[model samples]
Target: MRSSFKSSFGSQSTHRPHKMGYFSSRILPSEPSHFTKLYFDIAPGQLPIVYRDEYNVHFLGLEKLHPFDAAKWGHIFQYLKEAGVIDETAVVKPNEASDEDLSVVHTRQYLDSLKWSWNVAAIAEIPPLAVVPNFLVQSSYLRPMRFQTGGSVLAGKLAVEWGWAVNLGGGFHHCSAGRGQGFCPYADITLLVRCLLAHSPAVKRAMIVDLDAHQGNGHELDLGSCRNVYILDVYNSGIFPQDFKAKAGISRNVELRHYTQDDEYLNAVEENLEAALQEFHPDILVYNAGTDILEGDSLGLLSVSAEGIIRRDELVFTKARDHRVPIVMLTSGGYQKRTARIIADSILNLFNKGLISRTNRNVR
Candidate 1:
């Protein structure tokens, strides 16, 4: 039997599936597995938005050394709450993914490597973390990633049942099964898609729509060879993780130059996505929505306006809805302090445009 937990939105749960037959009238997985605890029955009253405060990383001011926003997850939720887009009672809290949970995709050697602070410090790109004790690193950093990773896994299941789901934190596209980079310590995107394909009966083909400014070389290396997993990557050619070898994994690739602006970027996304969908229909869509593409984002090196980001999200959600494909959205790479507000605003735009809502449950 699968595990279950009850809690108010924004509230933490000790731990963390499905009814709409939304995934093809298939029965749930019955045998015991590492995924049982991650897949549970959720009440209809809850929205498929998964998050928890534990997703934030707080250390002895060490997190500030990295440009990435450590508190972006909490900020996004708080903004949504302040805007009345969500309440404490409406969202689903996720469990921290255990070592066993991560074992589904990550190599045992890679998992064991995290026991060393030096290794973790390298993965997080926070050189100062190397001197910190392993326990402190785990508690202050990796633990939070575990929770977001778990949220991504849970959101995959939720998306199939609810037609769509958003994990407020996640989109660790730079971590593969055996390696972690670009501040991504776990292959959450890989795990999410792998879980759905392995356990969800209806999901035979999954499409990853990665719009992060940097290439999603992590998941590309992990899932690229799978015939059933199609990837559409739109990234700046000049950015990090320019894994040329991983380019083979992308079923459709759209490369952008440095300082590429809205019209060209958005047009490429819309055109390639439309063409990709027409060529390879998927049972589920994993949208890696990264706010790092904003104009002033130094790391992203793109010139997309905040409104462009919103429109990009809207376009993805709208296409998914129009095509009747369930989508699971992940807040990927966004480095700026304002990235959180931009994410919240984009989500609000999604809500306002009726692209995402509780009422549009997959009840059929």
Candidate 2:
């Protein structure tokens, strides 16, 4: 006695057979067209230096210490190549920083001194082991530091254009406006940031994520008061350049206690970074991905392992991507045994994740 229309409205009658092919076509995903750019200092080995004391072992294996040593960084390229994650290329030579470019964050006096020293050293007959090498160690110092600073600036520009980019050498965070501190000859990050901000309209604001075991005291000083820049430094609390936190207002210095492990450190990063991102919705993110946090790092006081370091890179880069912020990365500070390869590998993992895609060709 049921009505004929009742059958038409039934679930069985209304349902159609699922088409496997159509379903698969709609759900399948294509490979992402993401890439990474790696900027390097090709002649880093040629930079002049005068060995003063027995501490020359610090610069041994000049090729390895070349700041942009491929042996250390080549693995990163190889990994990306093997994984088909990125199209890699080297930065061209004579990638020198102009005087105007250096002046953005450095004092004219310092720049002049650097130039005079290089000019004098080039002509001097001083011994390799001399203290000053008869070079005009003036108030203004520029030259090799410019190369690194310029390279990093270029990297930042490329990262903004692309999604990610890496500077094989940089993170000279200890350099300040008036003087160079620690091993930093120039405040590379400062100069680079200033250049990026002035040139790029897209980058209205930026955030620096410094994960070096040492505090980025100089960076805090240089960019602390700037309204557009936000800095988060995760380092050992009580070491080097004392009174850094007090001076640098924008910084969140996470002073790790000695013997801190992976979980504790990572948790701290997770907790603080969320707040920082909320507070500073930056247009660009710069990561000082230092490998000095490795378990047995000579200069690092923490006991983070190789895996821990990789996780650190993952956390920061992932957060950048999630927030849709372009990232510029630097190989900051890492002086453990076989420092180069270890640092390179850590960066490669991030490169392999399809970050840093601009090449020399794309850069203007």
Candidate 3:
């Protein structure tokens, strides 16, 4: 018979250390356990951003996937291996998002526009421009926004089934029902949430905790009328997409001033998130853990540090654990020297600790 806790905490309890022996004896198959999937869509050979003028100080680093991201994720994988949290069979890969999947949250007109832009840019034989009028750059030279959107949906599904999953990219919260804006091709987070609602009965209620430097305006618009969804965005005020409005009364759109510190930021998160948790009582939490809040981040105006980021994750993860709600984490935005690794490590660390606690409980 399945353990009682198995139904409560989802599948994680089945792999608890004390239960491992029982699992191996009764349920373990001849086939090896699959490693947790980490989805990625960015091409490896993309060029770093460059500018002609010496005074321009181009963010060349932004062009290519940062080395630190891979390193941090690699470190986390190593830690998981040492702790036996994952098996050798774990794998990572790119996932494609279909038009049907995107239609769950986006209009067909917007989706076609993205494809049209890509084709037109190709036919014109012009290198992709990051900033273009009347066209949302879905596919940049470095990151294809569609791939990231698809990856988020794939990761969310995997997390539901396996107890945890991560998307190496995504956090494009600026896309809307009729249009895609703010460097995001599609509202990836919103799309994923819609997918969950369609496919998973376990996810009756969901709370989106967006900690990106920019406000999740698009998500607010897309999920505003969603009866069972709640959105809480903590972002800098007076930035892009000016004249912000919260259509959903449940939405808590807190705007911070420029140069906010780590403590101040986290305090806001703790306070607002606590309130949201009490009121919403969601079954699932989707966190847009953006690294842009880091002090050195190019676009982030906040002064949050690395340790601060960890604290934020801990607070949110602990809430999910206490509520016995599963979490789907998406990498929203991070544009520092080694932002990817830092973001990846932070997520892995959360899982590592959660696993350890479960193991300890089993032993006791």
By TM-score, who's the top model here?
Answer: 1
As for lDDT, the candidate ahead, 1 or 2, is: 1
Candidate 2 lDDT, 233-272, residue by residue in tens: 7776646655544334334556676666788788767666
- For model 3, the superposed segments whose C-alpha errors exceed 4 Å read 1-89, 92-94, 116-143, 246-250, 355-364
Show where candidate 1 strays beyond 4 Å: 1-33
- For each candidate in turn, the TM-score is 0.90, 0.69, 0.68
Candidate 2 Cα misplacement greater than 4 A, ranges: 1-94, 115-143, 245-247, 355-364
Ranking by TM-score: 1, 2, 3
Report the C-alpha displacement of residue 280, candidate 2, in angstroms: 1.1
Per-residue lDDT of model 3, residues 111-153, tens digit only: 6665555443332223343234323333332135555666677
Q: Write one digit per residue (lDDT tens) for candidate 1, span 90-150.
A: 8789988888889988899999999999999999999989999999999999999999999
Q: How accurate locally, in lDDT, is each candidate?
A: 0.85, 0.58, 0.57
